[model samples]
Target: MNASLLRRHRGFSLVELMVSVVIGLLALLFATRLIVSGEKNKDAAVGGSDSMQNGMLALFSLSSDATAAGWGLNDPMVAGCDTSFSDASGYALPAMPRAGASITPLAPVVIQSNGANPDLISFNSGTSQAGAGSIKLFADYTVGNTLTVDSKNPYGFNNGDVMVIAPLTPGSGKCTLFQLSGFGPPPNSTILVNSGGAYRFNAIAGLPNPYKQNLAYIYNLGSPTLMHFHTWTVSNGVLLLRATELAGAEAAGVSVTDNVVSIKAQYGFDARPPGPNPYDPTPGADGMQITAWSGTMIDADSDGVAGSPGDYQRIAAVRIAVVARSKNAEKPNSAGLCTATPVAPTVFASSAPAGVAAVPVQVNVAVAGDTVSWQCYRYRVFETIVQIRNAQWRP
Candidate 1:
């Protein structure tokens, strides 16, 4: 009984204790490694999910704007039409393309710097309000500078509002874009269309002989209210969607979304014959097939003339690509991984127009001063084709 008690009370030997400690340490290390790997994978999944969400939102916003392009504005007439207008506030709105005009109605779809940096898209639409919202001829003043509206006119335009004036005569396509300078309050009504200085309605460049017409229709293109011109651009890692009148003050830009690294757009032109309507050129049975996908701007209507209105009239669809990156960095920054800029696919129609490049593009842009490598992060690519509803037909 004494010998048995001695053996039971005995502690482990030095060698046996060391082997037991080693086994315990190995098990602990294995568990820790497993946990770390799981956490890393979880992070990667969450980052990928965030990028997908960002990409979808950005694409939706872009699609909505592209669909609305060219709404309300009719096929412009070259006989006696003008595209330039300004208001008393010094905000210049040009319906036609100018050297640096931020808003251009002639080219309803404008893409800038397609592959390099983030591309800029400027889409234009007209206001769609009728009855009280519609333009009415109240009093045709001889001065041509001021026009009086009926007290019942409910449009209630404010200063710096962009307005479109069109002749209501049959077969008349004469229209002009102007800015509302001042207006009299409610009961008594006078709309000051121009406030001196190059702000007059005639500033529209080309007006037919015998300009003053009684039956004129006016459409209010909102200043900062309803968006008339949409400019999508990226600044400092943020995607901004600015909604304002072409004649609005510079203070009206609003940020739309974030985490959008870049946006690429290609113009889809349909060069088929005229539709049921001889003058209205429509995309043929092949479904407005893409003739050319331009990284820059393409003349929608080519009447074999330069700077003509025909270009904007033929645009049927737009193919857009939006790229998003994870907001968080998961791994250490390195020289090899996230340094190359993805090139825009030069191929058109087959797969490039669909936003798939002939070659798979891996964009791992390194952020300056970032400790984590961009390659250690996740990315998503979103692409969609938007057909301009208003641009489907020409007057």
Candidate 2:
């Protein structure tokens, strides 16, 4: 009887058990919410910081490059009018290029620059073209015929081919191209190839440039709008992009990943009014002319031509816009991808109205050293416009 009765006090009473369970449940509930809240906050912070760092890096470099966009050491060396571009025939040299020809490529362009130059600047030896020169000087040009490519030379070339002109030496001749500004392709490149050579992008759009095309640089290391960088291709049904590695890698370009879902970009242009109300309506036009560039100038949709030339020319600036999301959204069971809730809210700076935001930031590539020296800084939109206009400086 003693042993049996001893077991009676060993078990928990009903009221005591209920109380213990309630206390435990409450603590667990609180702890779970705390952990989830902390994780959400951390994700938010990381996303915001990453966005900022990437934005600044991209903005600074593009700005500086644009600033020094067309700088060339020679009076008429071609620095950025689509260097190394070939016609539909695959030969980059165009038989004839008028002022208003289609500069926009329907597909990836195959072009290269070898810095070949005309031996002399012919002047008064005239045919009577008004723009023709009469004095003798070293001729520098945006265009030229290919000189011979000798295996023994830096410019290993065949005798009757074409090449962009550059100096035989780095900083010497008007006969050669020099970097007045420091962005885009080398002002005078004999040979520039990408890391994979021709292995990075869609096979159909392959080209020989190191980064597909010069200064065809992209954001987020060439994720979205990479079409802006070089070319796009499909190999065995897989989509890929080719990028020149700055250095060190076995085909170092990246493939699509889960964390980054979609990337879209828009170039920012300033639409200023001659006065302030550039948007006011005129008699015939939908609206009156304005100085500030608006969406009308942007080929964000990539229809090729800019809708407005005055506005396009005035595109004194550009900003890049991107959309990124977690790859988890692509999963079927995941809560609908378009959640009303944003794990991380983005912060942006804009000058437009309350509802509109401007993502493009300015860069000033202008500097005393090389025009490319501009890639390290930023500028106001119009300031960039001024620089673009100044690209016509001769001598």
CA RMSD of each candidate after superposition: 7.0, 17.2
Which residue pairs in candidate 1 collide? 301-310, 301-311, 333-373
lDDT of each: 0.57, 0.27
Our model 2 lands, by Cα RMSD against the true structure, at 17.2
Each prediction's total of clashing residue pairs, residues at least 3 apart in sequence or on different chains, is: 3, 50
lDDT (Cα, tens digit) per residue for candidate 2, span 1-395: 69668768578778889999999999999999899778766665565555444444333433343443322211222221233333221212211121344332111121111111100000000011111111211222233221121112232222212223322221122122111111113333332211222322212222323221121211011111111222212222122233222221113223322122112122233343333333311112232222243322343223244432222223333332222222111111254343322232221245443344544322111222332222122221111211332222323
Q: Tens digit of lDDT per residue, candidate 1, span 341-395?
A: 2343222234645543432233324445656645555667788778875655444
Any runs in candidate 2 off by more than 4 Å, and if so which? Answer: 1-11, 73-290, 294-315, 322-395
Using all chains and alpha carbons, the TM-scores for the candidates as numbered come to 0.68, 0.38
Best by lDDT: 1
